[model samples]
Target chain A: MSGTINHGLAQLAAVDQGFFTDRSGGGCIQDNKLFCPGWVADNYDRYVHPTLQHLVLVGSAVAAGFLIAFALAIFAHRHRWLQTPFLAGTGILYTIPSISFFFLLLPITGRGALTAIIALTAFNLQIIFRNVTNGLRNVPANVTEAATGIGMTPSQVLWRVELPLALPEVIAGLRIATVSTVALATLAVFANGGGLGTEIVTGSNITFKTGIIVAGSIAVIMAILFDAVLLLIGKLLAPWKRKQALV
Target chain B: MIPLPALTLPTAAFGLFGDAFNFVFDGREAETGGVTVGGTSQVLDLAAKQLEVTLLALAVAILLAMPVGLWLGHRQKGEFLAVSAGNAGRAIPELALIALMAAAIGVGLVNLVVALAILGIPPILTNTYVGISQVDRASVEAARGMGMTETAIVRKVELPLAVPTIMGGVRTAAINIIATATIAPLAGILTLGDFIIARNVYGDAGVLAGAILVALMALALEGTLAGIQWAMTSKGLKLKRS
Candidate 1:
């Protein structure tokens, strides 16, 4: 029991001392290099691993959000009475500040990736759900009528006609969710879910400019990269939009 | 550090919600150095600070972005600028912007306000531009044919018509600013975030109470702004609504 307490205290001491001091035998400002490449080189595992973890956290949350929100959107669409309550609930969830959401989940999930992903997934629901419903609703009435007249079942019409027509808006929703999630996932560090935010938080705590710049730039770059890729996917998915643009 | 104990799912969930309720209703005098509570005055004080930061940032963003967006929209120019700026702003994470500002300006209220102002700008700017450009071009043309100057056409016809959309943008910006302002404590500004950031000192009760407070404040701001948005809409616009 005493040994366990000592281990906990040591960990606390290390956090207080700052990770840089504990790892590099000094502050981040050794030899006037704003960020010592040597230190980063030595600590490649720290940076690289966190970046990958950040990607996994964000990717899983977006995927989970898409599946859940899509299912909810379909259910709400079929039953008109459910739409209002469903949207209102997700809107309330989105309105809760990200920090509050994280702490609210902390006790139940503890400090880990699960907590971060769940919070992130909740945030994505409003955007994805709204867009999915809007897209399906925007499908022209005549198209659905024609599908039904051709002996298509309601389910068949949804799969063959409505979903295909709704693909543009759905993909647009995905782009928005993907970009915002990349940004919000940085908060995962506070929840003990390792991500680029870990570096930002540590840098801020220690006043390390190099650490802040490197991590901050990487996060921004990641957001832009994800956004661009999603935009490309959006264009590819909706080739008619490209043809319209050409005209 | 609290020792880990295995908890059933129901119990953990109950504890989470129940703890938050108790913190707001039954929390005792704080034994910490961060956010003090047990009295209305302390909670009110932090809420005021949070509002001040949010309002100041939002005001600055409006001052800077609104005129440019309005002019560009009136001229029907800079479509690329408006779209790209909105996209770029959305792409930059709020935390990164805050950290960058802290590094550049050093930690303080100023750093947080600057970062948050940048966050608030895009929505308002884009909305203003879209709102103005989307005004009935026929009305603008009619005003011009009636010998109204470009400025007069914009002021008398375009601006009033654009109010709903512009207000829509402001609503979005206001909510984003209010939500992001919770992070101000990290930049050495005392706000509701102090409750969560100093959880080790304030304990779970303080953290939960803080979360509840922030959530309530955000909801109140959103509700108030939505009311304003609705009130500002012209009756004609309301009648035209689906």
Candidate 2:
């Protein structure tokens, strides 16, 4: 019985020495361990702001891109001649990699969220615009003619009939754009437009694995959430299609 | 880190661009050693390194992704796998990918190749499957009726008909790989990105120069691939000239 008490006291001493304690107390950072669980738990608060910044960046860029691309698509839908130029313009922008696009904006906009957003918006143009145009084109001719026979104006037919049907493809484009932007926005660190990448790239130690893992995981989760939400929105917009599935 | 007096305006920016252009054509002096940093030869060498690394990765990806995509496509299986791969690929953060890979597995040429090849695979795989799936089923039936071997049918019919779509995937993969390669310097390989990444050594002009050159290279590569894809497409299959 006395020996058992002594052993318990010895184990307590080991805990006191910090062996049983969290590695966040310093040892993990010192050793540069691959993944310091304790260190991550302690340090995760630092990533919150950067994560928010990343969200705002993606939201603003995609919103602006959709508006611009949607307008262009509508206008081009009427004027067939505009299609080639619009496609060519957006195609060129899409071909330029986001990192290069970011830096190329530096001289013009300087480094900040504006530069990052503009660059990201430029990247979104092609994907969303193409889908919207294709969706508009793919609207069945009979549906339009039926709407016209019902005394609906051309403008009414487009807004009420064509745009609603095009929602599926538009949402698809948004999902692609949004997911890609979530991934691409990490490069906003280069523009000094803070994001999770700020944590991944410019920490006290950049190659620190735990920091990268934390940031990357958050970005990925954000992407998945965005993709799911967009998909749900698409289904909600097309309740008729959802009901069809029930049958 | 250099604090310039007043070069933020567009005019001043244009001047900087001019300096960047000069730096690429005629090398600028290094801060210490009085050596030239960027000129034609050095830029060309780094660009070449980027291309070499890109091609190596792309070749590996084609070898791995194509066969699997083609096989699955032939078997008409793994639709979920093929489709999800494209979305999942888009979701991977490029910066974190490189940083994490470098941190987790030590950086080298071979390791970099592995990183880029994996990045390039999904689009190639997805596109290959979609391309093969889109081939007219009747044509495959016709080939089979003629007693052509499975491999022969795949090679002679599906591949030829699917060239446009298949090449579209290659173009996407190539653009991605080449783009990612501009950041290869972080992993210890010297590429054109060194000029941009190492701003302290090369200054703003070199950085700007690096950005322009990388953009041009990516666009040029895309254009060349489009041309090659156009050539590879069979004449009878040329329905639309988009």
The candidates score, on chain A by TM-score, as follows 0.81, 0.86
Cα lDDT tens digits for candidate 1, A18-74: 765656624445543445665565455667866888898889889999999999999
User: DockQ, per-model, please?
Assistant: 0.42, 0.38
Q: What docking grade applies to model 2?
A: acceptable
lDDT of each: 0.78, 0.85
Clashing pairs in 1: none
lDDT of 2 by residue, A10-36 (tens): 989988666425545366656667777
lDDT by residue for model 2 (B1-242), tens: 11112237888788889989998999878755477899999999999999899999999999999998898877778978987897899888888888888888988899889999988998899888988877889999999999999999889999988888788788888988888898888787889888877777888888889899999998898899999998999888887554
Score every model by TM-score: 0.86, 0.90
Lowest-scoring 10 consecutive residues by lDDT in candidate 2 chain A? A238-247
- Candidate 1: residue A110 Cα off by (Å): 2.6
Candidate 2 stretches with Cα past 4 Å from truth are A1-25, A203-205, A242-247, B1-7, B31-34, B240-242
Q: Alpha carbon lDDT of residue A111, candidate 2?
A: 75
Q: What are the clashing pairs of model 2?
A: none
